[model samples]
Target: MPGALTGIRVIDLTQMLAGPYCTMMLADHGAEVIKIEPVEGDPTRRFGPFPEDDTERHFGGYFQGTNRNKLSLTVDLKKPEGRDILIRLARDADVLVENFRAGVMDRLGVGYETLASENPRLVYAAIRGFGDPRTGESPYVDRPAFDVVAQAMGGAMGITGPDAATPMKVGPGIGDIFPATLAAFGILAAHRYAMVTGQGQFLDVAMYDGIVSLCERAVYQYSYTGRPPVPEGNQHPILCPFGMFPALDGRVTIACPRDSFWTELVTVMGRPELASDPRFRTNADRLQNSAQTVEIVESWTRQLTKAQIGQALGVRVPYGEVNTAADIFADPHLKAREMLVEVEHPGSARPVTIASTPIRMTATPGGVVQRAPLAGEHNDRILAGCGFSASNIAQLRESGVIS
Candidate 1:
């Protein structure tokens, strides 16, 4: 079956996580994503968990995890002939994604304006730390940013840890991945508009701004209370008993933000009489005395295993254990949902299992149908399709323009 984006073509000039993640989504849904790497390849090819016996470092888990379902083409963008090849590809591409620092593409003479002239319906999307000047300017535009920088400046770190005195970065690279998700949607929206109106536009996603959008609750909460919200450990600032609590062997999260659920939870705790108690009668009262409420819950939970508590509580309230990676790997629910998939390892006899795309469609489900391409693996095929003769390709390779 054809994917939803089967007809779309993406010129991927991105490295590392953020940009590649966006293109990965597009490719998973059947877009022809041609990853244009530098002659040295994406830096992540060196980020490893390399096979123990492998002498040649073909690639690593970091690159393979995200770059799956795409074609690879190597070009020396510093060389005129190589840069010209990208321009030719852009002439027919539906989207071009790049994550270089500000003005790098323009300096190379392949900025959005240059490509939009070639294919007016092109969606030239750029992902940057601060965004492109064509959209808005930032004093920090020239400065580079990474996931940690985005998390710190974007308000996520301000309210994510044990307390106000300590802030923690999120485990996942959400600073990059979130912006990539937003960029994928933006690209699709722009592609739709171009198909209808025959006009292309420059779109940009700033990682800092993306994380700010992700932390929108903090923005409104600060405005409403005139006080910066502080981290409350594993507890929710507004909802009582809606965070992690210790079990006999581990921890579980039980949420009962409403009176009915709270009443049910207290009943399951074998303390039905406390339902109307003044300190725990309503959500607001419980929030005011959250510490006491946690004690009341933990006093019962600490005696029981997480499984025992879950089985007793049943489905009357939102409840879950604090699952580790191994727990997830063994979870029946994940298996039923087909969340884990096996892919062929690049240079190993043993296959590797990785997370599949979360999206599901009855007729056109999207997933990691292909493994990540070896560096410059599709050079001849991609270039020949772009009208390069065999001799031309050989000469380009000989001259160190293409690899």
Candidate 2:
């Protein structure tokens, strides 16, 4: 079956994580994403975790994981001819996405205004550290930033660690990934508007802004209490027993924000009377005596392994074991859901496993149907589609406009 964005053509002029990930989402759902790389290629193409014996090094794990289902075209946007090529490609493209620092594309002569002139219905999107001036001028507009900067500046790191004094960056690149996810949604929404009105607009997503949005709870907490929220370790600030607890083997999480669930948890813990105790009866009471509540929960949980605790809680309470990668790989639920998928490695005999798209559709299902492309792998094809002849492409390559 054809995918959801089967007919949509995307001109992807992005590198690294944020922009590539956003375009990857579109490509996974059947957009014809053309990734325009410089001669050196996206820096991630050299990123590691390659198979032990693989020597070709066409792409590494980071590139493969995010750049799948996209075509590769190398163009030197520094050159006027290369800029012309991009403009020509965008003339008919449904969308164009980039993640350069604000004003870089405009300096290269392919900014949204220039492209929108070529295609009135083109949805030109940018992912930046702060944001583009066209949307709203940011004080840090010209500053370069990455995931860690966004985390620190945007409140995620402020409320992430065990304590307020020791802020810690998140393990995953949520700063980039979350903004990418939002950008994908924004692009789709803008594209839908363009399809209806025949007018496309430029859209921007600031990495800092995205992280602030993700830390929304912190904002409301400060607003209500007039005190900036601090990291409260593993437990939630308001709910009792709503965090990680120790098990005989590992850690497990239990959440009981409701009285009924709290009652059910105590009953399972072999302490049904605690459900009626003044210190732990209602959610508010449990909140006031949270330390005692945690001690009681831990006393029961520490006596059981994660599996044992899971079996005891079963489906009555909200619970989950802290899952490591090994645990996830061995989980029957991941297998049942087809979340893990294997793709052919370019130079290795063993196929590499990567996560599959979670979006499922009955009529137009989308997924990883192709591997990440080799650098400039589809240059000829993409150029041809842009109305350049074989001789023209050869000349462009000879002139150092393309690799």
lDDT of 2 by residue, 1-403 (tens): 6899999999999988999999999999999999999966877899989998899998889999999999999999999999999999999999999999998998888888899999999999999999999999888999999999999999988887887787889999999999999999999999999999999999999999999999999999999999998877888888888999999999999999889999999999889999899999898999999889999999999999999999999999999999999999999998998888899879888999888899989898798898899999999999998789999999999998888
TM-score for candidate 2, please give it: 0.98
TM-score of each: 0.98, 0.98
* Tens digits of lDDT, candidate 1, 1-403: 8888999999999998999999999998999999999887888999988777656677878888889999999999989998899999999999999999999999998988888889999999999999989999899899899999999999888989998899999999999999999999999999999999999899999999999999998999999999989776899988888998899999999998788999999999889987999999998999999989999999998999999999999998889999998999999999998988888776687777778889888888888898899889999999999999999999999999988
RMSD, one per candidate, in order: 1.1, 1.0
Local distance difference test values of all predictions, in order:
0.92, 0.93
Worst 10 residues of 1 by lDDT: 50-59
lDDT value, candidate 2, whole model: 0.93
Give the winner by lDDT: 2
How much is the lDDT of residue 342 in candidate 1?
A: 82
Estimate the overall C-alpha local distance difference test score of candidate 1. Answer: 0.92
